[model samples]
Target: MQTTGISYSETSVRGRSRPSSFRQRFKHSASWLKGVAVALTLGSLLSGCGVVNHMIYKTTGDVMQGFSRDHTIPYLMASGDLAMGCAMSEATAPLLMSFGRVTNEPDQLAVMLYLSAGGCAEEQGREHELAALAAMYERKGNAAEDAIIRQKRAYSLAAKRYLKGWQHHNTYYGEPGTGECPDFDDDMDEFIYFAGLLAGLQALNSEIQSTSSIGVPKNVGSVVARASSCLESDKWWGAPMALKATVWAMIPGAQPEGEDAFERLAMTDRMGDEAGVRLSHVFHAIAATNKGDEAMVKSVVRQHAESLKEQPANEDWAFVDAMATNMIIAISDRLWVENTGHRTPLGRLGTFWDDQKAEVETMDLDGLL
Candidate 1:
């Protein structure tokens, strides 16, 4: 009775209700929705492949290398635990070398690997230099004719290792026409580039300290000057500035008009503070030491200590942070070995041993003997 007349909403064909046709259309729509969802899922995965690969490579390299520097080596070095540091370096050497060997094509990761390898070589050179210093100290009072010979030999070995380090770093950048210098889209490229420059600087320092006649290449300075401009706007402003300051201080009459090297060194502190990396302090201290400016050295060292106290933790770039700490500690180690026959005091590596004195005091061995 209620359906005596067909409702306007109902479709009829040949006196038959078309409810089945509606069902068929609904089914077709459901299939189309499913296909659309599958297509979207595939598209998302395809679009994310490059990003995923990049992340994987970056994370792997950082974690492996960072752990070696931050957790294993620096702590060992700081605590005067060289045995373990050497062991760790040896164990990791093969793995690090493998990265270089596997890559025939130049890439960002390749550059990082080379830089890390160069760092390893540089550290080895430093160990030799320390050994030579210790040898000199051993013959401090005795008239040992052979002491000079031994020290010279050690210095020569150190210089060779440093040269090797420089060569490894030069593989990525610095050479006029040889290096790949591949473009990268992240902070790592900057870090690697800066590291290369640092290697060149260290190589030059090693040669000078060893009294070697080997001259620094003219192109090294040119490359550093050109590359530093790129780092000025990033978190690494302090690094390039420090490099410039170092170059100015080292080269005879190289300082530009109205530009003071010491001031440039000081400016790095603020930039480093903002970026949470104080490696510039190391460069500052080294340059000051080379100039025999004890006052400036102490000031920078004190500032470094205070900065460490303020930020005791390294939340990012642990490797670099640890390297900075290691370098500062090494400075303290040198002072202590020459004066006190020990490494730095437990927690006073960066601070001046005596604030009233501009120069480090040597021990009076006459009374102790």
Candidate 2:
């Protein structure tokens, strides 16, 4: 038969042309491969973007942390404004603390910041407590009850925040009394270490006052008492010894043989007066209060008042002197409220309700103002 011979490439069977299956398969595979390549490129870009963002965040954190520690802290320490310092600390803590998320954790700064904030809350609690006691003394039962609630709430917050500070301190320096003290970088470093110890002890005391189960370690006081020896007490204006002695007074059997807490406190009292930093007076007064020696507490307050007039606060460390003065005023206010149902008069810190008439003492109001 004379049938037309169709070429194999173009041949059709059953009235339909057959396409090249291999060529179509190859084209589909190439298209799929192109999509995969695009996806990989996009993934790489996204990953690189994440890396860049992290680097920026980390660098910013470093700068902010460094500036805050080096500049902000020094400036605050030099200024004699406790209320302003407290407000700044409370307001800026969360902002500064957020930096830790994008970079290395700022445990050292955290120790100081939380300690300051806790102190603020503790001060508020103290005011409320004084008010409650005054109300009770005056027979205002409902007001006394309300003040008690506010005082406990403030104390609970202080306890929690102070405990957080202690935790960060432990993270930065290792747990106190667990091992040898770290080699501190500078005076400020050592000061921060001491502050951390104070924070730990404050955590314990605040928790007790709050009457809450805040998980403050029972041994924190003992640990801090031992750790106080790590610092140069003389350079720190007797604060370390004051801390240790206060611990001895508070904790039964904490005092060692041949070591009288009161003698140490007396020595610290002189050191602080000479240094124009009377933080030791606060410690001495606290010990006296714990022993229920009201006269001694008042005596410490009187001594601090007289010292302020005898010599001006150290210009280089005005903030510390101011802090000590503020604490002493708080004690005086408590005494005043308890007995006379009022805070210490605006300028009458050293005087009391039953004091014999004497020449008024003058003081710079840097601490109060």
Top lDDT model: 2
Off by over 4 Å in 2: 1-44, 357-369
Clashes of 1: 0
lDDT of 2 by residue, 208-321 (tens): 999989999999999998898898888999999999999999899999988999889999999999999999999999999999999999999999999999978987678889
Give each model a TM-score: 0.61, 0.85
Error of 2 at 267 (Å): 1.0
Q: Model 1 segments beyond 4 Å from truth?
A: 1-183, 211-219, 351-369
Candidate 1 residue lDDT tens string, 219-298:
56545655566566346748788877877786777678999988888888767766667778887888898798877876
- Model 2: per-residue Cα lDDT at residue 217: 93
